[model samples]
Target: MSGDHSTYAPRSGFTKWIDTRLPLPRLMHDSFVSYPVPRNLNYAYTFGGILSIMLGLQMLTGIVLAMHYVASTDQAFTSVEFIMRDVNYGWLLRYLHANGASFFFLAVYLHIARGLYYGSYKAPRELLWILGVVILFLMMGTAFMGYVLPWGQMSFWGATVITGFFSAFPAVGDWIQRLLIGGFAVGQPTLNRFYSLHYLLPFMIAGVVILHIWALHVTGQTNPTGVDIRKKTDTIPFTPYATIKDALGMSVFFLVFAYFVFYMPNYLGHADNYIEANSLKTPAEIVPEWYFLPFYAMLRAITFNLGPINSKLGGVLTMFASILVLFVVPWLDTSKVRSAVYRPVYKVCFWLFIVDCLLLGWCGSQPPQGAIVLTAQLGTLYYFGFFLIIMPLLGLVEKPRRLPNSITEAVLSRRQTSAGRPAGATAAPEDRG
Candidate 1:
């Protein structure tokens, strides 16, 4: 697929000269305009395009926010207030940027879940998956840094708490923590550094996104049936077809985003953030943004010590390991079948895993006491076990149902069944081994 060159022809002498030099237009045409996509892809496939739009929106809004944003400890919170009240349309920009983060995460989570459901991370696309995980990590860092820019109560304490996580390391933990904050605590230096990094990481994410797309084009997209595209009938050009669908999906997404931005701008933010940072006082309950809650729950779930490892360090490691484990998922799930659609047993386990994650997120949001703590511990265990144990074991023991011969076959069979017509003969049996 990577070798599939653009068939674009220059229409003018100037265009021909540029095409010979850069071929930039040609690359765009090949990647998006004339790209061949599986005809059977569902709405889930549209999230990728939606996410791209969100990233662009974020970068554009963030740049404008930074123009008026004061990153100093003394003026940061007031600057945000100024943006809301004094600056022209600054309230709109700030709200859009803030809420855009949530929308971006929402789209990305769905995109990742879609990938997991269809085995988009399997062989020949492992690097594509890894690049995606890299983008995720970068996004988390950028968001965390951006959150600290407000320098409000939660912003200050959240920074203090999260940066202190580095102190969980055995010997050099303290040193690392000090380095991160640039002082003894979350102060002017910390705010300055976060501001600088917040500005930098998104562009880095964009760079990696380019690589992710390149890798995607190389391997081509995986379909619902988990079968490779073998014929022209299995795919369609991306222009008009896929592009139109993506445009519609993006329009619907922006409608929801606009509602939140206009009517419920502060809906996703903490009320405590309205108050300025107070080094002397801390909120009774410190919580992260909703998106980070699941991993945060995992971090707080470690209440007991194991051997030489203390609970603090263990929790930190567990929280990070949860994300790190995704890097090796392609190898961990031994099943040759990519999509869960044909893998009944795997489908059940997949939903259970999703539930476990939600439980952990809920646990993270609540106080870690009594039932919540126990549930979080259980959920965390299951989260790891799903990837480490169940995925591998299921691949070896469970039988996947028959897969369609091609993407076209899967689409037609579904259509035939929906129309109350008999589907064509099934393909030959696939090797279980």
Candidate 2:
């Protein structure tokens, strides 16, 4: 599939000259126009395109907002208010930038979920999956910094709380914390540092995104069937086929984004954030954004020390390990089978894992007391166990359903079954599940 890029041809003399000089048009034609993707790819595959669009939208809005934004701690909150009330369409830009971050995370979570469901992290794509995790880490850092730019109550406290986590490390912890905040605490220097990094990280993300896409095109996309393409019939040209689906998916996604932007701009934001930062008077409970909730829950889950490890350090390690675990996921699952579709046992476990994540998110938002703390501990256990225990064990003990020989057969056999024909009749007995 990676070798199939010879179909592009310049139509005119001027175009031909440019093609010989740079060949960027040829590269685009090969990558997007004629690239062959699985014929049976569902809407789940569209999130990649949606993410690209969201990234572009975020950068554009951010650049505009930065023009009016004040990085100073004293004027940061006032500058945001100025953008919302005084500048032309500044409110729209702010809403788009703010809400766009949420939707961007939503799309990325779904994209990662889809990857897990379809085994997009399997062998020959391990680097692709690792690069994706790298992108997620970069996004998290970018979002955390961006969250501080508002310089609201939550923004100030959130930065202080999160950055303080680094102090859990032995000897070097305090230094790391100081380096992150640019001083002893979350004050003027911290605000300046975060604002500059927040502005710069998105472009860094864009660069990594290029490498991610390059890796993806090199390995090709995984389909729902978990079967590789073996014939021309297994795939279709990307232009009209995949492009139309991506466009439709993005259209629906944009409508939801627009709704949040226009009608419920503050729905996803904290009311306390509307108030300016007050170091003297702290909010009752400082919560990070919703996207950070699950990890926050994990961070809080470690209430007790394990031998020499203190609670603070344990929680910090656990929180960091949760994300780091994903970097090794391509090697964690022992199964040769890609898709959960065939692995009924893993399929059940997968949904349970997702529930555990949502449970953790809920736990993070609430006061960490009584049942919530206990539940979060249990959820965190299951979260790691799903990767550390279940994934490795299930692959050896469970029996997966029969898989079709190739993508073409899977598509044809599904259609045949929907038409009331016996599944076994469409394929040889050995290939029938």
How well does each candidate superpose onto the true structure, as a TM-score?
0.96, 0.96
Q: How many residue pairs clash in each candidate?
A: 0, 0
> Across residues 1-433, which tens digit of lDDT does each residue of candidate 2 receive?
2345568889999999998898888888888989988999999999999999999999999999999999998899999999999999999999999999999999999999999999999999999999899999999999999999999999999999999999999999999999999888899999998888988889999998999999988888999989887889988999999999999999999999999999999999899999999999889999999999999999999999999999999999999999999999988889989999999999999999999999999999999999999999999999999999998889899899999999989988888778756645778777765
Name the regions of candidate 1 deviating beyond 4 angstroms.
1-5, 421-433
Give, for candidate 1, the lowest lDDT window spanning 10 residues: 424-433
lDDT of the structure predicted as candidate 2: 0.93
Per-residue accuracy of model 1 over 1-433 as CA lDDT, tens digit each: 3236466878999989998899888888889888888888778889989988889999998998899999899999999999999999999999999999999999989899988899999999999999999999999999998999999999999999999999999999999999999999889999999999999999999999999999998888898888999998998988988899999999999999999999999999999999999999989999999899999999999999989999999999999999999999999999989999999999999999888888899999998899999999999999999999998999999999998888888888888787653222343346222
Clashing pairs in 2: none
lDDT for each of the candidates?
0.92, 0.93
TM-score of candidate 2 relative to the true fold? 0.96
